[model samples]
Target: MSDFVLTTPVVLTIFNRAHLAKRVFEEIRRAKPTKLYVIADGPRPNHPYDKERCLAARAVVEAVDWDCQVFKNYSDDNLGCGRRTASGLDWVFSMEEQAIIFDDDCLPHQTLFRFYQEMLDRYRGDDRIVSISGNNYRFSGQRLHYSYHFSRFPHLWGWATWRDVWQRYYDFKINLWPEIRDNNWLTDIFGLVQAEAGPSSEVFKTICRDEDIRYWSRKFNIIHKEMWNTWDYQFFFMCFLQNGLAVLPNVNLVSNIGFGDEATHTCSVTELANVPTEPMTFPVLHPPFMIADAFADAYMQLIFNRSC
Candidate 1:
């Protein structure tokens, strides 16, 4: 592979997963990025290893092998999931016009760096393209378009976006609860409600409903919410409300390797290894598509309940 320069900076949001955190840091180091934003979650009071893991995670970033600008947000107290992530992203947006955001669990292919560099430049001014994601799960069905497609979901695995879009984010489901319930937005956003919702659904949706920042995102009329999280189902809902689009690649550029039993969300036992490790080319085009209404319900019954 060849050296790739970033057109936009990269931001990494991490908690206390020291082992996976080390892998993420190493990937970035090998890619030789110019700038890196590290959002390290604070330790929980009375939690024995939380602080130690957080510090270990920080140490990995500090040991980046290349000449790079690193911004650290080592919180003094645990902010939990909502605040830690929301605040970390807020800080990243404040620093750069655009950034490729990552959570520690994700491991990028060697060429993902180059792919982002090219796509960020191509779609920077295009309001329709809200993000440049490292993961694309729809590669098999769709022929490769531009390495992404126009969707309503945010792929949290490893993704990129501009400050202009992030600035409009607010905790809509909370601050504007009346509007959300009145509009019946959650059902529409997530498609159909699941029969046996997973623990994370309640937690995730509760945050969406109660969190202040999320309410703001709903109210501000943000154009798109692109991410690599399996929660893309809900993301599709939020983005759909805004009438936004997502760019999905025909090739599976990104993969979720968080299937181990120790994982917070995905703890599947059946191992899926020996996958291809090549970066799909960019400028890939997407075909026409339709949103699956009951997709969320089926996913909950199939994936979340039995596995996670």
Candidate 2:
């Protein structure tokens, strides 16, 4: 892996967790990306120690020892998760055409960088492919013969995307939700006639409705508010609207360490907390057809619900 240096730029999003940021930064140091973009949100006004903690987290990024060009986008006012991450990524794509993104707590395996680079190059011009994800929640002993599979779900624990796809997110147009919902656009996207005839019809319907009958509904609504401001969800909506697919690894590559007392969204210790990571083989074997794996996605939803 030493010979394969990661040439893609990395965009890292961080808040106030300096300890988790340090742990994630160590992995980034190992990859040694050519350019590092650090996006840090400002501390909340109410928390007395938030300013100090936010500064500490930013300091972790300053410890880059390798020869790399570093860029920083620090916010002066707390923008919360929705605005902070969305605006930060907007800044990133404005400068970079494509980049691998990591949250402060998403610790990736060494091969994760390589995987993103490879997939990004392979599908750079393919508009049908929107993003490359580093998560595989299929812990039920299901395995793919190929290196990765296609899905509509854009898992952002650790992921990569291009500017073209990211531009589709329109935060101000959230009021059009009533129009979109009333038009039954989801049925068209999922091809409900066909999906309903399939074995996983119910699962497909649930995904199309954005109704995770599990535990994420309340949390998602709280963060999203109007449902268009949240960065990752907006990205997912873009992919679905474009009939796009996201590349998902056959094995888990990111271990989320943010679920704890300090986390904003991930405050509970669930099955996804600090999940283990594994190396991915080079020269990936692509799936024959670009289609969402329904069974795998259903299983993923189940696991997420259980965690919540």
Candidate 3:
């Protein structure tokens, strides 16, 4: 473990992957945060092996021998990804004002904790900046004078946020979907033509129609159907709706290791899987002006379109 200790609280969400959970937990152990919150979902009733896997995963959290105040929000029943994660986050913000959140598959570099702590302190009162993300998927040579850039994409592989932002804007229900769609909120945020031509437009159309394509007969499988029912899209919707920006590190800090048969959503290996992490330099360079990088956003939209 390094001499550096994280002052910010960390919230980790884990399911039934013991090996991946242990790898991520080791990073958390290195940070040695003062407070740790573990949110876990119970095993699926249909899968016999899920129970044992879930137990093993939880044991990793219990094995933390560091001096920390650990909190748990393990569910007795499988609440699905949507309900379980949303409720777990609700519980987290209820107790803490702000926290750095992690999924079991998201392995962070040592500097990630320091970067989050500094960024959180720097933008604590800035409502415009709602989140700080550790993963930077853009591999382009686009260099910024700052250690981070403002983006519309709030990548949640590993991130940090304040309770005020979560409570005020993050809606699990997508309650504002109708109003947002009818009033052309997407167009307003990403330009009228871009919104109409992008993948987000398809998602907006789906949400507005409440069309359950589960039985649409054209879907490749049940996984494709379940993919639409995700909270990440809802969080992105919230960020767009609130005109909120997410700060992404200049260097990639987190690697995703959850793509396989056992994975819930990310079942296919992509270019983003297991990306090498690099340490971020201190005294973070700050952009002179607060504005989203259009080129980066366009590249991200391209990635989203391809992924869908």
Quote each prediction's TM-score. Answer: 0.71, 0.87, 0.87
Stretches of candidate 2 exceeding 4 Å from the true structure: 169-175, 187-191, 194-229, 304-308
- Give the per-residue lDDT digits (tens) of candidate 1, residues 141-247: 44323344544445556777777766664332233445765676655454434345676654233222233224433533332232222223333334555655544
lDDT of 1 at 122: 66
Expressed as tens digits, the lDDT of each residue in 57-79 for candidate 2 is 99999899999999999999998
lDDT tens digits, residue span 131-158, model 3: 9998787656575768999898898999
lDDT against the true structure, per candidate, is 0.59, 0.81, 0.81
Clashes of each: 37, 0, 0
* Greater-TM-score candidate between 1 and 2: 2
Clashing residue pairs in candidate 2, if any?
none
Any residue pairs clashing in model 3, and if so which?
none
